[model samples]
Target: MATHTTFQFRRRMRPHRLALATLAACLGSGLTAPVCAQDAVQTVTISGRNSANAASVAGFGDIPVSRSPFSASVITTRQLADAGIGGLADITRLDAGITDAYNAPGYWGQLAVRGFTLENRSNYRRDGLPINAETVLPQANKQSLEVLKGTSGLQAGVSSPGGLVNLVVKRPTGTVRQLTLGWADDASLGAAIDLGDRSGAFGWRLNAAYDHLQPPTDASRGHSRLLALAVDAQVTPGLLVEAEIESSRQVQPSTPGFSVLGDRVPDAGASDPRTNLNQQPWRLPVVMAGRTGSLRLTQTLGKDLQLSLHAMRQRLDSDDRIAFPSGCSAEERFDRYCSDGTFDLYDFRSEGERRTTDALDVALSGRALALGLAHQFTAGLLFSRHEARFNRQAFNYVGTGRIGALVVTPADPSLTDENTDRDEKSTELRLQDLVVLTPEMSAWIGLRHSRLDRRSERTDGSRPIAYEQSFTTPWLALSHAVGPNGMAYASWGRGVETEVAPNRSRYANAGEALPALQSRQIEFGYKHRTALLDWTVAAFDIRRPTWSDLGPCDSGADGCVRAIDGSARHRGIEAEVEWRAGAWNLRGSAMALKARREGAADAAINGLRPTNVPASSLKVQAAYNVAYVPGLALLGFVTHEGRRMVLPDNSLDTPGWTRLDLALRYAQRLGSRQVVWRAGIDNVANARAWKEAPFQFGHAYLYPLQPRSLHVSAQMDL
Candidate 1:
């Protein structure tokens, strides 16, 4: 690692100092949002020092999470490092109000809130912009993470009513260099390096991290790599120029431990860690590899005015397939008729499943009416383009092995005989205004207009047509400082969504074809904070009763407007409590919510009730500095989820399950605080929890959560 420390550079701050400083910054910055810091911290003998409430991405944490009228969570960088977390899934699993975020039986996990389908906006961002939101993999170059809950048709331009997540990148500072190393159970290995330097009126930073992991089971494997480089320069004092780039890569594969009829459990000693889950693991046919590259440039015109031009392009591709015995018992498979049918033996697989995305967003913000009724106003033009392609092919059509299947056409293995492809593009423009009425009150207004056009590039006559969509939405919010550190806010907004064509095989489909409809929502919440604590509470309602269909309406039809007016309610209570003092910090949240859906003819439709949503959830975490131990810290966190039902057809409710986890860490010294040590265990109870439904598997074909396991990791500066 190459680090440069100058006179402007300072050392790191203590946990207490950082927390108090951050909160103060939030108050002075006009943002009123609160965040939970990571459990880890790295300091430079010449390098450490640091620094909230209803905070928005615009400034300090002055905005409450309840402002979204839904719920939001801010996980700080400090907390992440202290706890030795390496992925987004791990981070989210510990948050309240987030259900089954990644604790599902399958590898591809998602976020569910208040019984609403918030998958589209599941990914998160930083500084108000999405960083690695769409990547199915975890991001390594992040400084902080933000989760926004609600139908964000207002903030994101075009999105579902479910919610959105934002990951803030850890950029370089006007200081020196820092590094960290840690070790944990399961032979986990990790290392991180960050360097910053200032040249006259210019500053630059570089960061990199790598991890190698092996879970208890043979099927669980993980490898991650990340790097980031950025430069900050003041070209002419008034004209400051900055550029940043970041990249991350991850590869993991898990063996499907299918339960014997949902509750099937073999003797623990009889299980073979090395045994391939039947012939499935070997035939996984699931492989994903991709990389994302991003760049940003911003300019400052004045003290209260600045404009940032941002551009980012990402590429992702994956080949996935899963297969199970066609019948439950051997008799059922051959007889073709048996109670509780078998799994799909033909092993449906997707080949050449590739998706590529390119987005360009430009934003400009400054005080239009400098410091009077308004201090800073931000207006920006956003344009995002996404091109996704899908290619599907089947192998071993009727049996477990390739030889037993009939080769309709000899396998050329080079893209031939039976395949499909699809592509889509979207563009949007948004305007946001931040008006500060008085030092005690503030108001936020925003508007967005967007368009979507798509086409299906098929090898056959697959309705190769084009469709366009135009949308305009406006939002308004008011915030007042009740007590010196308390804030109350109310907001109202309209949300709009269109039919997405990538996930589904066909658009303008037949049978249940549905049209696009509009949705609207309104909410209110309050926040309170002191030097040692912060918390919030909110209530909201969202409804969309347009004759519409975004996906296969259970009948493989597109453009079908069969009275599909779907309305959902998000009424809940969210709160966070934190206490910080010398060497000790404790924080956590308790959340409760109710989500209801209307406008469905059949109670067993399977597509209603916001598939995979939980009614109640809770989480708690605590940390303590072992000043006596010098460089040693202790940590613990736990999360829980309430019962949820099945909604594949919006027909029935699935059995509910609860899960628990425990973690601990120890930090020592290495390279000027660059290197370190740590270890811990998860799923302490070794208990089982099903995060999703069985779909066709059965009424309760549980999605079994992970069994208790141990993991360890380490990092070295050099």
Candidate 2:
């Protein structure tokens, strides 16, 4: 296993020397405080488990921007619950940069940052360590989610500048069993069970989640299941130990066909409901499924220091078969296919679609203050290693319609033997520290020297050696409170990314490997929180990724042409808000972004907006416990992203859309009243919707959203 660990963090001050101070208050009064004292500082959980007002400047400053040079929006467990969210993507879509990651027949999503690009980290994490699939990890008993939105030079000193996202899973609490069930408009149903216990020095907890739905919109059906278990114990009064394991599986089939207005329609037989069926010409054309299992452990050493260790194995499998449209407008419009041709390529067999990724990681965080240094600080070390492999067999048919009516165009099935396997090992040693320069201002500075050693051994096992590619990055930030809960700051950093997976490169069967890319950025942001409101707004400019295309080149060129003078500028604003009063809570976020690159063949276009990068997006939701009833509540959520470019031509695009989901819950005693029954509705608007990506192949061109449905369930609390 290859690993990266950083150990020393003593450096001269960078700038804006100031100390961080915290206070407690809500935003309802819309009040502001310019300067606060340390004696007045307090600690309150924004997680919403219990209502207390505490000011955490760490959530407000611009000075030390963690890993990304861009701004970040951190949503706590309380924030997620208050909004009544269901999945991981549901949380990620809360911000921008990420385009829809759904692919194949299932809602198997691949997360993207800035654009469709991601670094080796793939943006996956659990309690701060890698949990596998870099894009999206199954949300099982999750507690909080943090989005790092720009060039990542700090948190991941060596990773894709694309960005980073951290998911904090739930841990075993001291005591209690909690159960809840919910229903939504558009036909969404769900139920969850949570149990915890702490006796003397031992504690344990387990949680399970289930969701079922038949979309209100055309051809949309989705269902999900998840479970998480955790164990904790106080080996000693001041020392604690903890471990956790989690698993989840989500299967969502596609109804492929949709209307021109972005609604569901019948491309196949009218017998199929446009609102709840996939319209692929071939029956059982495609299916996708994502399953993950993870194990993690944590141990506290003492009062001033803590340590964490975790490992997880994840897998993604897909089987996709698509029928090409006979008369596609794009084909005719572009003159790529014969207009009067007797037969067109209609059937494609992309069989045995499979991808598996496994990862191991360990890290430690501690508190320390250097002698003679006039500041309090935080220091830590982390290391991780991951492996990924994918394989697929291709097939084709001569005719369309029923399989029995077509002729199998035969080819060497052994071609599948050509599949490639590559093992990448990376390591980093880092020592970063936060410094309190003065009572009014604080400066957080960190320097990291990291190396990524990688090798691509053909499926055949061979002697392994580290390809030493080492680089150093510096992170610095400065911030000052403008008011009690508001602060402004600026940051700068650089980032790195591994070449696209070697498997993808070999899929094209080029005899070589692609080189990794690098990116840089500068950004600023502001934050504030009061009684019923909290938000962070910021903007950033990121340079296009720079790297050499490692694919094979044609005659006439000395080497693979450098990707068309590749470069672009990304700038945008992001905001997150939460408002709660009495038993009602409302939450949401907005992102406004514009990105472009230099125009060149194979190179992303400059004038053309990048695919998956939307110009505007926003989400808002509210949930309230019933006022006139006992153990009852109501929930609603709405999320949307604006239009975006889809094809290289730029003019071809995916229209923007917004969807609203409403649900109700009723908790009442049954029989002896020891158990409670709960029920509700989903997709109140049952509004038809689809995310616009994957339109290029013209196979299964669309992914439809779920329709409105009903759900009923029961749970017991002890």
Candidate 3:
């Protein structure tokens, strides 16, 4: 016999809420929740289960992963804890389609999905509401992270065609009290607590954490603090309200990447990867502080109609300072370091930078029967506003510094002044319908009409720029059930992106707003799920316009003109699998990509591969419970990345690399309390390799993989 937990809800409860409770139970205790509704009350019984297979990122509603038309993945909090993931960049090890895009240590996260870089302004969400991802996002208060691959025109009006990431906030379930203590190499320490309870129709959850980080680097140290609160109330039999707020602060000195020495990639032994080039005596650590809040209200209008309203606000303040290195003395190749490993050093400082974002959404959904066919529909209106203020930055070249040498120059006395301001507002109307044509076949259609207004100005007596644009995008998909647990689907989608002229004096139309560019994606996929195995395979092709400098002007104020001159086309195939049977668990994902530039005006770059995107990648993770020990498990992880092009012409590239990791886990009950311990060693073989080499702003950077390190943690239920 197995123990069971039951939850009871009052009359006329929302189905989506019930599904959420079921998912929570599945994640919390590895149990399955089967729901049964009565005339006056509904009950959910939880028993033994294997996995949680439902997610809300697809936007229609809480749908099973096997039924969704698009490719998606969900990373639960338990997975994060087991892998010791601390930031967004660390998630790349779990998914092959995700890769770094200038993701430096101690800085905000930046990544690419399917060979396309994600736009920071419109590619992130929190509980279906837009939120700025420019600052370090605290993951302690998040229940799960959801990744939706491909065009999301129906969900987000203006977004990158690559994909979108959504963070789900932790909500109050039943009673929960847990504490976690963690440690890593170099004396890093962390502590966190989670508390939740329910009283009558109201419930609340609180999360708090603090971390002191001393990374395996020279003269680099940091600390962070986070606090979050979530609450919900069943105000009436047909109405429910929920709210959440979080505040976090982080201070750290950013590590700068190494540059190529002239036209050649430098040897790994040229300089110690642990050396922080920005470790000047007068340098200050980067400080980022942010607060976010959201509110949601759901009302049952009728037996088949429901209305929902969501609103969110986010604000971030940052003080950035660094001793940056760039360029060489040679005029021919100024973007690279000199042959003797010497480069120009600059004192860069930017303070009093503020960013704010606010979003609101109202939606109505219902199910109906028309023309003898069942239909599920959603109609929504969205509004969002973003604003940014920046102080005058200082980027002054100080002196030259050589690799493996310390040279400190006097800090410049220049201070910051208010200089730049930018504002953007967007409005969108969306409609979606899912029609069941037969018992085993369905079609989904969606449309979004979006309008954007943007303005920017500089206090340095420059011309201000403003623009207004509108577009309509469409999404269509058809899915057919192959069997009881398998489905195949094909989808096509269109999206839009905004572009601005680079703010450089060399460009004739610098800071000017350009016409909106459109992007398109076509995908075919199949998904299967069973009691012990789940798998998905997808093939996708995406295309978007690329902007570059077209013609060079004579030596005058107008040096050049930049415009859209080409298109970037990316085709890829990706597959993911998960299996759990007896005492063994395995998960793996693989991707093969071919990304190139087409129809380019510049002959040198035509038909060339994009920078920093790998041709192939693979990731796998496994855990096995000891049959005799009863309380111990063994864990292992492996990752491999194919060679990545470093230059647009594909003349320079980095070799493929492989990494291996091992860990152990032990769980036991002592005196009516549950305790778990985890220990892990990353990069066990201590392989020296370049993780990524990205070219940005005319400079080439080489980011190296971290050396071997150790991590340990303990968790207790109180």
Which candidate should be chosen as best, given TM-score against the real structure?
A: 3
Q: Write the per-residue lDDT of candidate 3 for residues 1-718, one digit (tens) a residue.
A: 1111111110000004322332232222221232222111111111111124455666766555667688877776666666667787778888899988888777787878998888777899988888888888888899888888888787787889889988899998868776656567777777777788888899999999888877787677888899999999999989999999999998988888887887788766455778788877888888999999999999999877899999999999999889888888654566677877888888888888899999999999977778876777899999999998887888877888777888888787385443668899999999998777776778889999999998888756465788888999999999887776678999999988887886678788887878777889999999877667878899999999888786665565566887888899999999988776777778889999999899888777877899889999999988777777765777888889988887767878888888898877666555655456677888899877888888877888888877788887555544
User: Which wins on lDDT, candidate 1 or candidate 2?
Assistant: 1
Query: How would you encode candidate 1's per-residue C-alpha lDDT over 52-164 as one tens digit per residue?
Result: 42325522224344332335666665455444455555554556766653333224545655445454431344456543343445444566666666667666655666566
- lDDT score for residue 69 of model 1: 33
Q: How many clashing pairs does model 3 include?
A: 0
Error of 3 at 237 (Å): 1.4
Query: For residues 1-718, what per-residue lDDT tens digits would candidate 2 score against the true structure?
Result: 1111111110000001122232111111223222121110111112341112211212222232322123655566434443344455555434554655443334434556656455334455555554445332555476556666677656664556667667666776666566656555445666666777767788788888776644444334566677778887777665566666666655454333332221222222222223322334343434445555555555666554555555555555555544433323433432122233212334444545555555554556554456534333334344555554545433343342221133233232232333344555445555555454443355657666666656555444432233546677666776655655566768777766555322332234233334445667777877666666666677777775544344455443444433324766677777766676766766667878878765344544446676546788887766676657755666666778887655445655656777765555444544433333334444456655555544433322345444444445444433
Q: Return the lDDT, model 3, position 55.
A: 53
Which residue pairs overlap in candidate 3's backbone? Answer: none
lDDT of every predicted structure (CA atoms): 0.53, 0.50, 0.78
lDDT of 2 at 599: 38
Clash totals in order: 76, 56, 0
If ranked by lDDT, best first, what sequence of candidates would result? 3, 1, 2
